[model samples]
Target chain A: MATRSRALLPISFVVLLFLLLYLGLYLNPRHESDDSPMIGKLAPEFDLPDLIATGDRFSRADLNGQVSLVNVWATWCPSCRAEHDVLMRLAATGEVPIFSINWTDRPDSGGSREAALLWLGRLGNPYQKTGDDGENIAGLEWAVTGAPETFLIDVEGRICNRITGPLNDRPVPNPENRQEVRNNVGNIMKTVRKMVAGEGKCLTQDS
Target chain B: MPYSRFMNGLIELNKGLRMMQKQLIKMVYLLLLLWAPLSAAAPIDSLIFETQLQEDRFKQLVQEIRCVKCQNTNIAGSNADLARDHRMKVYEMMKQGKSDDEIRHWFVVRYGDFVLYRPQIEARTWLLWGLPLLLIPVGAWLLLVQLRRQRVQATEEAPVVGALSESEQKKLDEVLK
Candidate 1:
């Protein structure tokens, strides 16, 4: 009986190890949502040229004293294109000012400063002002990994939330998925309203 | 005489072959040495730091931070535009006299612990760092217990040499007679 029990002990230990390993398989090592630690912190400051009006400059000071969405985008990013219509719709609502940073619009990377202006011209210019971050100096400060990341800044210029992916209601391109599309935009709007009301520190999707 | 001459020719040929092989190896080694530094050196960006120390720190910092776009690669090693931007950010911060901790903190604030190659040892990471230490002793103890048990079992199963069975003794006596 003792030998039988002893033999079973190692097997049980192995089973436990496998169980833990199986659990680990479900644990995502990479952070999902709420990964941007920039939430609740002061937004990084930048001064950049306006994408449309090259003579004019867009700076961090412009975001002060207003609840705004600073969207990091570029002509090269397809996700940015995907979110442009949503941004236009949001702008039509006139709920909040949408500032844009044209991130990494260098010609070599299939991005041109002129192309950004052309996009805005064609897309109806949803942004109050578009900053041309040609050299990505401002983009780096904001820790922008890619285009179509939106940062919600409160009246006090503090970043309240960061949306990493495209700001579409439906992540999928299918127009038929109307239900999924409604929830995402509504959620963003609700969060923005909450931030404006000074109800939350950082109202992110996961949080 | 012709045989001896043939032997001498063969020996000369062997000597020539050995010399050529040595020279080839030497040339290969020299080429490898020349290529080594080029591969080791990361591409330097246009942004320059004030001092060599600052530049070195910038390089080290970029390598420490993970590129969000290229999830598997460090910003310094990635050629993605975002990685380039991150590298520039690190350089800019270093030039501004930011400490290593401060720069790392800046990235952590923006990108969470995932941005760091070496995550901070905190409450959340206790298991990640402590598992090996905990498992090693447990494994050793289990091995020791199993070995001791096996030793005891072996002793029990072995025949008692001095206290032989009566039938075995009778057989031995008959054989001796």
Candidate 2:
């Protein structure tokens, strides 16, 4: 009993120290959500032929004086479909120009380019312009891996933010699926507004 | 003497002819061996990385780093196609003569320091690197305390063994005798 009692304090100290060490080692990687990868880099330069036949090409130069969101999506991507409403609403805000980069879509793969055109036609064109990246040329240039990824390019043609999933701005959150919400459209707008008002740095590279 | 010389010349001529046939046969065999590969499997002229090291080191790096998509699995092991694509990107960068630090820096530029598996030892990570060193002394002290307790217990139990039974004593005597 005496021996057991004598050893308890050191043992407890060691256990506590180990626990503290592990906690410190493991917990250091997490950061706040608004920390995005595209925050500070110059937006990838692109000049894709417009998909909508709006008689104008979609180019980074066109967005020089405005803050815009470039959403990389495909009709085939279910998450894109899910996030469609959020994008439509964000577009309705009309404060920021929202552009869509349509990625590779096959007919058997949910919706093709024709189907996407039809869907957009029926839904009312929310974007000022759209680019059809059928061969994934823009995707490779932007280092885009898949669809439903969004980037917030500031007025200076610098990529200010990149949200790697679907956006949800509704008060009641959609049931969480495989793609966790990276950034909501509302949050992105708030950040852009703050940056424009000179309230706080928008985590973007100044052109 | 003339007959013997003629016979010797005939023998030399036969030897030359046999040599020529052997050479021809060898040449034909060589041609066949050269033609066999072309006749069968399609020519795979592409460079492929078939070795484990090429795959594992990249995987090891990715597993340690968090996926930008899924907050859990490292980008290397994540089933997310994005994660696979990131692994491929890392591999391609490594091939392009980028050092591990440079690759890490590239990710940091985009994702910030949150992408690193082992966060750099900086103002925010002093405690992380220091904790392992700190545990050593604590572990040693615990071991010392346990060993001392064990020694004490051993010493305390020694007295009980001194009281031997009479039957044991009789057996001992018998063995001695």
Residues A59-151 of candidate 1: C-alpha lDDT, one tens digit per residue = 989988878889988888998898899899989999989999988878878989788888988889899998988898887778787777888
Native-referenced Cα lDDT, model 2 = 0.72
Model 1, residue pairs in steric clash: none
Per-prediction DockQ: 0.57, 0.23
Indicate the DockQ of the complex predicted as candidate 2.
Answer: 0.23
Best candidate, lDDT: 1
Model 2 per-residue lDDT tens digits across residues A1-207:
988997898899899999989997787455445455555667767888788895668877876767778888888788888888888887888877788888766553456779879878887677888988776656655656567888777767777666777788855444474234346565567677876776233453332
True contacts kept of each: 0.95, 0.50
Interface Cα RMSD of candidate 1? 1.2
- Listed per candidate, the RMSD to the true structure in angstroms reads 10.5, 19.9
Off by over 4 Å in 1: A14-34, A53-56, A169-183, A194-207, B1-62, B92-100, B154-177
Model 1 native-contact share: 0.95
